[model samples]
Target chain A: MKLKCPTCGREYDEPVQRCECGEPVEFKLFEGEPYIAKTVWERFYDFWPVEPAMELSLGEGDTPLVKSRIGRELGVRLYLKNETANPTWSFKDRGTFLAVSYAVKAGYGAVGTVSTGNMAASVAAYAARAGLKAKILVSESASDEKLKAVGVYGADVIRVKGDYGRLYFESLKLGEKLGVYFINSDNPFRVEGYKGIAFEIAEEITPDYVLIPTSSGGLFRGIAKGFIELRESGLIEEIPTLVAVQAEGCSPICRAFSEGKERIGRFENPKTIAKAIANPYPPSGNAVLKLLREFGWKCLSVSDEEILEAQRKLAGEGIFVQPASATGVAALEKLVEGGGIEEGAKIVSILTGSGLKTLATAGQGNARECPLEGLENCVSF
Target chain B: MKLKCPTCGREYDEPVQRCECGEPVEFKLFEGEPYIAKTVWERFYDFWPVEPAMELSLGEGDTPLVKSRIGRELGVRLYLKNETANPTWSFKDRGTFLAVSYAVKAGYGAVGTVSTGNMAASVAAYAARAGLKAKILVSESASDEKLKAVGVYGADVIRVKGDYGRLYFESLKLGEKLGVYFINSDNPFRVEGYKGIAFEIAEEITPDYVLIPTSSGGLFRGIAKGFIELRESGLIEEIPTLVAVQAEGCSPICRAFSEGKERIGRFENPKTIAKAIANPYPPSGNAVLKLLREFGWKCLSVSDEEILEAQRKLAGEGIFVQPASATGVAALEKLVEGGGIEEGAKIVSILTGSGLKTLATAGQGNARECPLEGLENCVSF
Candidate 1:
C-alpha cells in the first residue's frame, strides 16, 4: 500500500499515519470497478489498503441516503447521508471498523485512540469485538458521563492530565512503543475507511456538492480521496464540489481558508455546543487546506445558533443529529444566500453523529403537564 | 384491510386499534410474493394494509442480522437482529413509520402515542417527517433527559400525571375523538410494520429459534405473524420457534404463560433496570400468550443481573444495547440449560434499542487517571 503526504509530497511504501513533516499521510488513489456486495467493504473491494475484517464489522457503512424536504425549501435537491444509523450511531464506526481491521491484521494486540467522544467509543467497541485490548486516552476535561459509553465496551480508558493538544501526538508515540495500534482522527487507514461514505453517496445519486462537518479534517480528506478515486476509476464523470463545514465557535480551518493562508494556526479558547467538531488545532488542518486550495473547494463555519436551528430542523425532518452533524445543513442557507451554490444543484450533507450523545445541550422539548383526567383537553388543540 | 382479534377470533372489515373485547387487533395473514425493492415497505408491498408513505420514511427497518460470538459459548449459532440500528435507534421506528404512513393517508392531521422511551421518540420523528402534529403522552415519572430525544423531533410531549397504564387506552380513545390517530403499542399497522424484521431475518437465515425481548408483546406478535405469513406464502417450510424473553422484575406475559393462564394479570409495582421492557400489563399480553401456547413456544425471564451481564457481553462484541435489548441474549443461557433449544441451533435474538437511550442505568465504565508524563506507564501492561 503506497502512502503519500498531501501537504509535503513525501511518499512511503509502507503504511504510515503521518509524514516526516508531521502532516497526515494518505493512501494513493485506487482505481477499480465496483462489485455487487451487501457491505461497502466488499463493493469497493480494491479501494481499502487492508482487507476489512468482515467478521468484526458492526454494519458500519451503507447508511441511507435519505431525501430531505429542507432541500426543496432552498430550491435544491438535498439528501442526507444518515451516518447516525451506524453501529455506534456515528460516522466514526466506518473509520474505526477499517482501522481496527488493519490493526488486527498487523499483529497489534491492542488498539488505541485519543478521543473522548465518537472515536473513543468506536475504537473500544471494535477492539473488544476483535478480542484485543484497548487503551483509550482522553483529555482531563472529558466528562465521566461521556466516557460511560466508551467504558462499557471494556476498554481501559485513561484520562491523561496534561495539554489535550499534546495528548494526541503523545498517545501515538507511546502507542507505537507499546505495540498499541493508535487509530487517531486522521490515521491513514481511518481516513481510508471514510471513503465508504463517498462511495455510498455516489451509489445513490451524483451530487453537485457534498457538505461535510470537518474537525480534524480526516473525514474531509477521506471523502475527497474517495470521489477522486471514483473519478479516476471512470465510475463518476466529475468529483462533486466538496465543502468543509465547521462550527464558527472553533473554526481554525475555515479561518485559515478565508484568510488565504496555506497553514492553519490554533484557535485559542475553542468552545461550542458541537464539541465533537471543536478541534482548535486540527492535526490534518494543513492537509485539508491544501486540498481546498488545489480543487477550489469551499470551507465555511456556522454559528452555534445556526447549528442548533439546523439540528431542530433536521429533527423536524425525522433525523435528529448532534450539533456538529447539523453544521452542514446550517451552512446550506448561508451558501445559498451567498450564491456560492447554484439554485438547482443536487447537494448531499453528511450527518456525522447521533444527537443522543449530547443530550445535555440539545434544547428541551415543549413538554406540557396534564392530569390523567384532563389529558383529553390537554391533547386537544 | 381485514383485522382480526387473535384472542376472541372476532374480525373487523375496517382498520381498528383493538377489538371490542379489548385485545389488540392484527391484520389477517397476507399471502404474496416478496418483491425486489430497496426498503422493506416496498419489498413487502402486498402485505401492508395501507400504502406506505415513501416520502415520509426515516429509513427504518432492514437492520443488520449480525452473527454473534456469544452463541458459540452457549453451543448455539446466534445472530443478533440489531434493531438498534433503526432511525430512532430502536425497533419502534419500523412500527411507527408504518403507522404514521396510515395516519397520513387516512388524512389525520395529528398522530399520538403513549410511550416515554423508544416508541415516543419514533412516533415523534415520523410525525415530524409526515408533517403531522404529534402528541407523545409520556408518564409522569419519565425523565426529562430521556424526553429530550423525543422532544427534539418537535412533538408535543405530554407528561400525563396519572396511572401510566390507563394512559395507553385513554390516548387511543381521545385520539380518535380529536381526529388524532394514536398509534399506540400493538396498533394494527404498527404490528404489520414489525413484520419487516421477520422478513429480513428469514431472508438471511431460517433460524431454528427466534428470541424476542418482550414488553408490550406488539413486537413478538408482529414477528410471529411475519413468519406464519412467510410459511403460508410458501417462502419458508415452517415458522421458527419464537421465544418471548422478559426481565424477572416485570414479566406479566411470561408469568401468565408459565401459569398456563389464558390471560395475564398486572404485575404489581413493576421495577427493573430494563425500563424499556417494564410494561407490567402488556396491552397484547393475552395475544402473545396465545401465540406461545399454540406454537408450543417458550417464555423466559432473566434477572436484572443477567440482563446487565448480557448487555456487557454484547458490548464486548461491539454491539452495545440497552438492558431491554439485552434480554434475548440474557435468556439464551437459560434456554440452553433447560434444553429448550437444541445443540447448534440457529438462534436470532432481537436487540431492541440503543444503549444511549438509557445511559443513566447503563453501568459506568472504569476510567483511570494518568498524568501526561506517566501516560506511557499507565497504558503499559
Candidate 2:
C-alpha cells in the first residue's frame, strides 16, 4: 500500500509522515476483506501502510450490530455498534488495540496517549496486556474519579498543568524523545483500527447516513476509510453519507463545513458537556475536511443542553452514554429540529463511549435512602 | 411445569406467584430442551417465556458473554457475562422483562417496584417498552442520581418519606389495591427471567462456579434454577456451585450460614458503600438461605473497601460496575485470599450493572477546568 496526498495527489513508497506536496498522507485502499489474514505481525499481511510494528490481534474485527428499541422513539432506525463492549469500554480500544499492536511490534519501549476517558483507559490497558510501558498524559482538571479509573490499569499517569489542547501536542514531542509511541490523537495507525467499526456497521445494514462524534477526527477518518474499503471490495454498493458531529462550543469542523472551506482553523473558547469531542484543534482537521468535501458530507454542532438531553434520552432507553457520545444523538436532534434529516431515513449513530466514564458531568447522583426505621413516612407514587 | 414447595409439598397452578406453602416455589426443571418461548412478535423465534398477552420485551434477553483478558492476569480463565450491559444495564432486565410481560398480560395498566439500582431502571424502561406504566417507589434519600436514571425511563418516581427498607413490602400492599402488578422483590415469575443469565452462562461455558451479587437473592435463586433446569434436560452432568456474595454490613445470608441455620435474621445496622447490597432485611433471604443449605453452596461477606477495590479491578479491565455489582469480585478476593477458591478454578463473576449509575458513591467529578487562556495557572494532576 502507498500513501496519497489529498491535496496534490502525490504518492509515497511508504506511508509517509508528509507528502512532497507538504500535505499529510493517508493510506490508499484498493480493497479490503471481511476475513482475517496473517497476524498484524505479518507486514507480510495485506493491511494499511501506516508505519508501525505489527501487533497481533485476536480477530477484534466483528462487533455486534444492535437494533435498538430506543431509536424507534427518537424517530430513527438507531443502531448501536456497542464499541464500549470492546476489549476496552470505548471505540478508542479499536484504534488503540491496533496502534499498540503495531507500536509493540515496531519495538517501541512504551505506549502513550493524551486522554482520561476511553482512550487513556484503552491505551493503558492494551499496553499493560502487551507488557509494554504506558505513559498517559491527563489534565489537572481531569476528575479523580476518572483518574482512579485509569490508575487501576497500572499506567504511569502524568497529570500536566496546562491547556489540555496544548498538552496533546506536547505529549507527542515529549514522547518521541522518551521512546514512548503516542498511539493516539493523530496516529494514522489508530485510524486504521477504527475501520473495524465501519466494517461491523456495513455488515449488518446499509444505512442512508452514519453520524460520528468528531474529536481529533481520527475516528471520522477511520470510519470513512472502512466504508471506502468495503465499497472497493464490492461488499457494499455505496458509502453512507458520513456526518461528523462536533460540540458547538468547539466546532472547527462545523465552522469549516459551513463556510465550504477546505481547511479547519483552530477552535477557541470550546466548551461543551461532550468533553470527548471537545478538541479545540484536531490535527486531522484538514484530512477530515477533504474527506467531507469529497463526499458532500455534513458537519453539525449541538449545544450542551442538547447533548445532556440526548444523554438523558439514551439513558431513558437504558443506554447510558457519556456527554461526548451523546453528540451523535444531539446532531440527530438538530437535524430533526431543522428538518434536515428526512423522516424514516435509515440512520446509524455511533455511541463512541460509555457514560460510566464521565458520570461527574451529570452532577452528583440522586440516589436517596431513608433510615430503616422511617418506613411509615413513605408516600404514594 | 408445576412447583412443589419443599417444606409443605404445596403446588401452584401458575408459576407467576409464590406457592401457597409460603415458600417461594422454584421451577420444576422438566424433561425437555432447556427452551423458553420468545415474544419477539414474529421476529421473536427463540426466546425465554412470556405468557400470552404479556409481551413485555425491550429486547432484553440474549446478552453477550465475552471472555476476559483481565481474568488471565489472575491465572484463571474468566468470563464476564455483562448483565450490566443490558438495556437497563443489569441482569435484572432478564427478570424484569418477564415480570413486566406477565403484568401486561394480566391486564395491568401499571407495574410497580421499590428499587435502588437495576430493578428500578429495568422496571421503568421495560414498563415503558411494554406500553405499561411504571410506578417506582424509593425513599426520599434514594440517590438523586438513581432516581434520575429511573426517572429518565419515564417511570413515575415516587419518593416515599419513610424507611427505605420497609418500602419494598409497602409497595406490594399498595400495588394490590391499585390493581397494579407489583413485581415483588422475589416474584416467582421474575425468578424465571433471571434464569436466562444461567442459560446464557451454560451455553457459553459450563462454569465450575457462578458468583452472583446477592441482595434480595432473586438473582441467585433464578440462576440456581436455570442450572437445575439444564441438569434435568441432561444438557449438563452437574450444576455449578452457586456462590452468593453480600456486603459485610448487611450479610444476613452469611450470618445464617455461619450459624448453620436455614433462615436469616435481619441485620441491624447496614453500613456499607455497597448500598445496593446493604439490604439489612432481604425478602428473598430465607429462600436463598434454604438453597445454600440444600445445595451446600457458600455465601461470603466482603467489606465496602474491598468491594470498591474489586470494582476498581474490574474497571481497570475496562468494566465499570455499580458498587453493588462489585460485591462478587470482593467475595472472589476473599475466597482466593481465604484459600477457598482453588488455583486454576474457572470462575465467572457477574458485574450486575453499569458503574455510571452510581458515580456519586465514588466521590467523582472533583476537578474543574479553566479556559486555555488560563493555561499558566492550570492545576497539576
Candidate 3:
C-alpha cells in the first residue's frame, strides 16, 4: 500500500494526498487483467488498487455512448460519452463511489470534501449510502442552490468565510485529526475510479480521438493512464489521441501547454459561464501538463459563446449538458473549422454533467408564448 | 397491425391511441420468446405488435434496481427501481422512446404531445434525437422553470390558453389532420415501452410486492401487463402484488378504488406539491381502476407531508427522487404501520423521477453559514 509521487519518485507506505515535494501522489502500479462482471467495480476489480465493498454501490458507471447527429455537419463520426447518465447526474459519481469504498474499508466513520458543486453532491450521496458521516466544507460565497443537492444527502455543509481556497489543503490535515477522510477533487482513489470511463469507452468503440472536458486535470490524467494501461495490456492496439478541452476564461493547463511551459501557472480573475470547470489553480495542473507533453496531446480552449452554442447543438441532438460539459463539443467545432480532424474519423466527446443542474441559464428568455384559441394556427410545419 | 380495445373487445386495423368506446386501445397481443439482444427494443421484439425502427433509441430502459437501507428498519427487503437514471431523468423516457420509434417508423413527419412536465421533456428529447418535429402543447399555467428542460430540446413548446383537459382529447384529432402523431400521456406505445420496466425488474428479482407511483394509470397498467405477459410466456411463476401509490391531495383513482367504484370519478381542485402526478382527471384512471379490481390489488394515498418526509428519507438513503416518486416509499411506510406487509418480504418500490427536477423545495432554507477564521473549530466529530 505504497503511494508513489510521479514527479520526485518518492514512495511512502502511509496515506498522504501529496508528496513532501508538494506534488500529488498515486498508488504504486499493480498489473492484472480486468475482471469481467456486470458493474464497473466488479468488471474492473483487478485494475482497482483497493477491493471495493461489493454492497457499496449506487449503480454508477456504464453510461450510454449516444451517437451524435452533429457529427455529419462537423465532418467526423462523433459519439457523446454521456456521463450525465451517472447516478449523481455527473461523472464525479465514478470517482466518489470508489473513494467512499476506500474510506469505509479503511474504517473511517466520517468523510469530507471541499466542493460546493458536483463533487460535493457526489461525496455526500455516496457517504450517506455507505452509512458514514459527511462533512462538506464550501466557500462562504457558495451558491445556496448548488449546495442544496449536497445537503439533501444529509451531509453537514459548512461555509468557510475566509481563505476558503486554502481550506482545500488544510481540510486534509484537519480531517486526519478528526478521523475523517477528505476526498477532495484529485484524490488517488477518485482518480483511479475515473479510469472506468476510459475502460468502458474502449469496450464500445476504438475512437481515433477522445475529447475530455478538463477541470482540475485529474480526469485528464486518469483517462490518459487508462488508455496507456490498455495498450500495455495488449487490450488496445494503439491509444487514441486524448484532447483536453477547457474554457477560455480560465484555462491554466491549456495556457501553460500552449506557452510551452513545463508547469502550469495559476489563472487570475477567472470569469467563465462554465463555472463548473473554472478552476483558477488546479491541484493536478502540472500532472496534466506532463501528460499533454508526453503524449503530444492537444489542449484547446473555447469561449463562453462557443460553449453556449455547443450546448444548444447538443440539445438539438437530444442531449442536454451543462455549459462546462459542452466544452468538449465546442472544441470539436473549433477543430473542424481549423481542419484539424480528418473527415469520417471516429471522435468521442465527453459530456460531463446534466443541464438540469444549470436549468436557470437554459430557461432564460428562450420560451415562446402562444394564445389558447385556434391553437392550430401556432402548429405550423 | 390491429389495435384492440381492452374494454369493448373491439378491434381496428389502423393505429389508434384509444378506442371509440372512450377507452385506450392497444396493439393486439403477439406471442414469442424475447429476442435476446442489447437494447430493449431488440430484446423484446417478439412481444412488440409493431416492428420498432432499430436506430430510434436514446438508451432508454435497463435502469438499476438499488437495494434500500431503510427497508431493514421496516422489516422488509426493499429495492428501489431507479427509473431516474433514464436519459431524461424520469421513467417517461421509456414510453417516449417507444412512442417516438413508432412515430418515425409509421412515416410521421411531425409528432405532438400534451404535457408540461416529464412527458413533455421526454417527448421533446426523443423527437429531437429521431430528427422529427415536436409540437409540445402545454397548459397556460405551467411554470417556466418546469418547462425549461422541455424547451431546451428544440421542441415547439406552445402554451395553450384554453381548457387543457379538453385540449388533451382535441389534440389527437387535430394532430391527425395536421399529419402529426399526438402522443398524450396514455398512448399505447408509451405504455408498451413501460413494459420494459417490468421485464427488466423481473429479470433481476421477483419481489413479493411491487409499489408503483400511479399517474394517468399508464405506468401501473404497463407494469401489470408486463408481469402478465411474463407469466403467459412462462418466464415467472406468479405475479407480485401490484400497489398503486398516489398523493392524498389528488387521489381520484385511489379514492374510487377504496370506495369500490367500477369507474374512476374525477376529483376537482386537486392540490399537491407533487405536480408531476397531480392529475385531477387522469385519462387512464378507469383502466387502472379495472386492473385494481381484476387483480385484487390495493390503491393507497399519502398526504403531502408524508410525501415530503418520504422524499427526505429517500435522500438519506443516497437516492434523491421527486415527491411523486417518493409516494411508493410513503405507501410502504403506511403499509408497515398498518401491518399490511409481512416481515422479511421482498418489496420493490419504484423511484419514478429524480429530485434534481424539484431542487427549489429541496434548497429552501436548508443551507447554513459559518465563519472563515479557525475553520478547524467547525470540524467537530
Candidate 4:
C-alpha cells in the first residue's frame, strides 16, 4: 500500500500525513471484496493498508446502528451509528487503535498526539493497552478535570504552554527524530481505520445519506473513501450521499464550499458550544471540500442552539450524545425542513461521543424538591 | 412462569418482589432451549419469564467479555465483562431495560425508581425511550450535577426529603396506587434482566469463578440463578464459584457470611469511596446469603484503598472502571493472596460501570508542564 497526495499526486511507500506540496495525503485504495466473516476485523482484514495489532483492540468497532425515532418524525428512515460505545467514549478510538497498532509494529517505543479532548484520550488508552509509552501533548488552557481521563491511562501528559498550532508540526518533526510516532489529527493510518465505519454501515444498510460531524474532516474523508473503495471492489453498487456537518461558528470547509473557493482559510475566534467540532482551520478541510464538490454533496453548518436542541432530541430517544456529535442530527433537521432530503430516504447521523463526558451541557433543570410529609401530593400520574 | 418464594414454597402468577411470607421471590425456572438467534433477546427469549417489549430496546445487551492483562500479572486467566459499554454506561442498563419493558407492556403510564446513581439514569433513559413518564425519586442529599444525565432524559426527578429507608418501601406502595410501577433496586423483573450477564458469560467461556460487585445483592442473586437455570437446562455441567464482592466499609453480607450467620444486619455509619456499592442494608442480603451457603460460594470485602488501586490497575489495561466496579479485582487479589483460588483458574470479574461517570475518583494527577521553547528536552524514550 502507498500514501498518495490528493493535490500534488505525489506517492510515498512510507506512512506520511502530508506531501512536500503541503497537501494532506491518503492511502491508495485497497481494492478487494471484504473478507466474509463474523467479526468486523475478519470481514475487513484485507481492506486496511496495514495489518492491525488485533490483540490490542478494546472491542471498539461494530457499534450498533440503532434506528432512531426522530427518523420517523422527520419523514426519513433514520439510523444512528452509535459511536459513543467505543472504548474511549469517542469515534477517535477507531483511528487511534490502528495508529497505535502501526506504532507498535514499527518498533516505535512511544506514540504522541496533540489533543486535549477525544483524540488525546484515545491515543493514551490504545497506547497503554499496547504497552507503548504515550506522550499526550495538550494546550495549557485545557482543564485539569478534562485531562483526568487521559492521565488515568498512565500516559505521559505534557502541558505544552505556547501556541499549540506550531507544536502540531514541530512535534511531528521532533517525534520522528525521537522514535515517537506522532498521530495528530488526519494521520494516514488513522484515516485508514475510520474506513471500518463506512464498511460496517454499508453492511447493515445501504444508506441513501450519511451525515458526518466534521472537525478536522478526517472522519468525513475516511467515510467517503470507504464507500469509494467498496464501490471499486464491486462490494457496493452505489455510494451514499455523504454530508459534512459542521458548527456554524467554525466552518472553514462549509464556508469555502459555499463561496466556491478551491482552498479553505482559517476562521477567526470560533465560539460554539460544540467545541469538539470547532476546528477553525481543519487539517483535512481541502480534502473534505474536494469530495463535497466532486460528489455534489452538501456541506452544511448548524447554529449552536440547533445543536443543543438536537442533543436534547437524541436524549429523548435514550441516547445522550455530546453537542458536537449532535451536529449531524441538527443538519438532518435542516435538510428535512428545506426539503433537501426526500421522504422515506434512508438517513444515518453519526453520534460521535457520549454525553457522560459533557454532563455540564445537559442543562440545569434541578429536581423538584418534595418535602417528606407531603410527598404523596407530588405522586401523581 | 410463576413467581416462587425461596423460603415458604408459595407461588404466584402476578409479578411480585416478595411472597406473603415476606421472603424475596424469583421466577420459576423456564425449561426450554434458548431461542437460537442473532440478538441476545432472541437467543434467550425462552429464559425471560415475560415476553419482552422488544420495541423498547436501546441495544443494551451483548456487551463484550474482554480478557484482562491484570489477569496475567495475578497468575490467573481473567476476563472482564465490560458492562460500561451498556447504553447508559453501567450494568444497571441491563436491568433497567427489562424493568422498563415490563412497565410499558403492563400498560403503566408511568414508572418510578428510588436511586441517585446508575439505576436512576438507566431507568430514566429507558422509560423515556419506551415513551413512559419516569418518576425518579432521589434522596434530598443527591447533587443536581450528578442528576443531569437522568434529568436530560425528561424524567421527573423528585428530591424527597425523608428517611430514605422508609421511602423505599413507601414509594412501591404509593407508586402502585398512582399507576406508577416502582422498580426499586431489587425489582424481580430487574433481577430477571441481570440473568443475561451470566448467560452471556457462559456462552463465551466457562470459568472457575465469577466475581460480582454486590450492592443491593440483586445482581448477585440474578447471576447465581442464571447459572442454576442453565445447569438445570443441561446447558452446562459445572457452575462457576460465585463471589459476592463488597466494599469493606459497608459490607453487611460479608460480615454475616464471615461469621457464618444466617441473616445480615444493617451496617451503621458506612463510609467508602465506592459509594455506589456501599449498601449498609442491602434489601436482597438474605437472598444472597442463602445462595452463598447453598452453593458454598464466597462472600468477601475489600478496602477502599484496594478498590482505588484495582481501579488504577484496570486503567493501565485501558479499562477505565469506577471504584465500585473494581471491587471484583480487589477481592481476586485478596483471594489469590489467601490461596483460595487455584493456579491457572479462569476467573471473570464484572467491571460494572465506566470510570467516566465518576471522574472525581480518577484523582487530580496533573500533567507535567512543558515550555514551548525546550519541548525537545521532554521528548525522551
> Relative to the true structure, how large is the alpha-carbon lDDT of every model?
0.91, 0.71, 0.86, 0.87
Per-residue lDDT of B40 in model 2 = 28
**What are the runs in model 2 whose C-alpha is more than 4 Å off?**
A1-89, A104-109, A128-132, A333-343, A356-381, B1-47, B51-76, B128-131, B304-309, B315-320, B333-343, B358-381
Q: Considering only chain A, what is the TM-score of each predicted structure?
A: 0.89, 0.80, 0.88, 0.88
lDDT of 4: 0.87
Scanning candidate 3 chain A in windows of ten residues, the lowest lDDT window is A31-40
Clashing pairs in 1: none
Q: Which ten residues in a row have the lowest lDDT in candidate 1 chain A?
A: A30-39
lDDT of 4 by residue, A212-287 (tens): 9999989998889899999999999999998999999999999999999999999889999998888888989999
Q: How much is the lDDT of residue B149 in candidate 1?
A: 92
TM-score, cand. 2: 0.77
Top-TM-score candidate index: 1
Whose lDDT is higher: candidate 2's or candidate 4's?
4
Worst 10 residues of 3 chain B by lDDT: B32-41
The CA lDDT at A322 in model 1 is 92
Instruction: Candidate 3: list runs displaced more than 4 Å.
Output: A1-37, A337-340, A365-371, B1-37, B337-340, B363-365
Q: lDDT score, residue B373, model 1?
A: 93
Candidate order, lDDT descending: 1, 4, 3, 2
Write out the backbone clash pairs for model 4. Answer: none
For each candidate, what is chain B's TM-score? 0.89, 0.81, 0.88, 0.89
| Model 4 clash tally, residue pairs | 0
Over A1-381, each residue of candidate 3 has an lDDT whose tens digit, in order, gives: 889999999999999999999999999887642223477777767888888765667888888887787888766888889888878899998888888889998999999998888899899999989999998998888878888888899999998888766887889888888899999989999998899989988888888999999989878878888889889988999999899999999999899998999999989999999989999899899999988888888899999999999999999878889999999989987777766577788889999898999987885524556776687778767
Predicted structure with the largest DockQ when compared to the true one: 1
The number of clashing residue pairs in each candidate reads 0, 20, 3, 0
Predicted model 3 interface RMSD = 2.2
Q: What is the TM-score of chain B in candidate 2?
A: 0.81
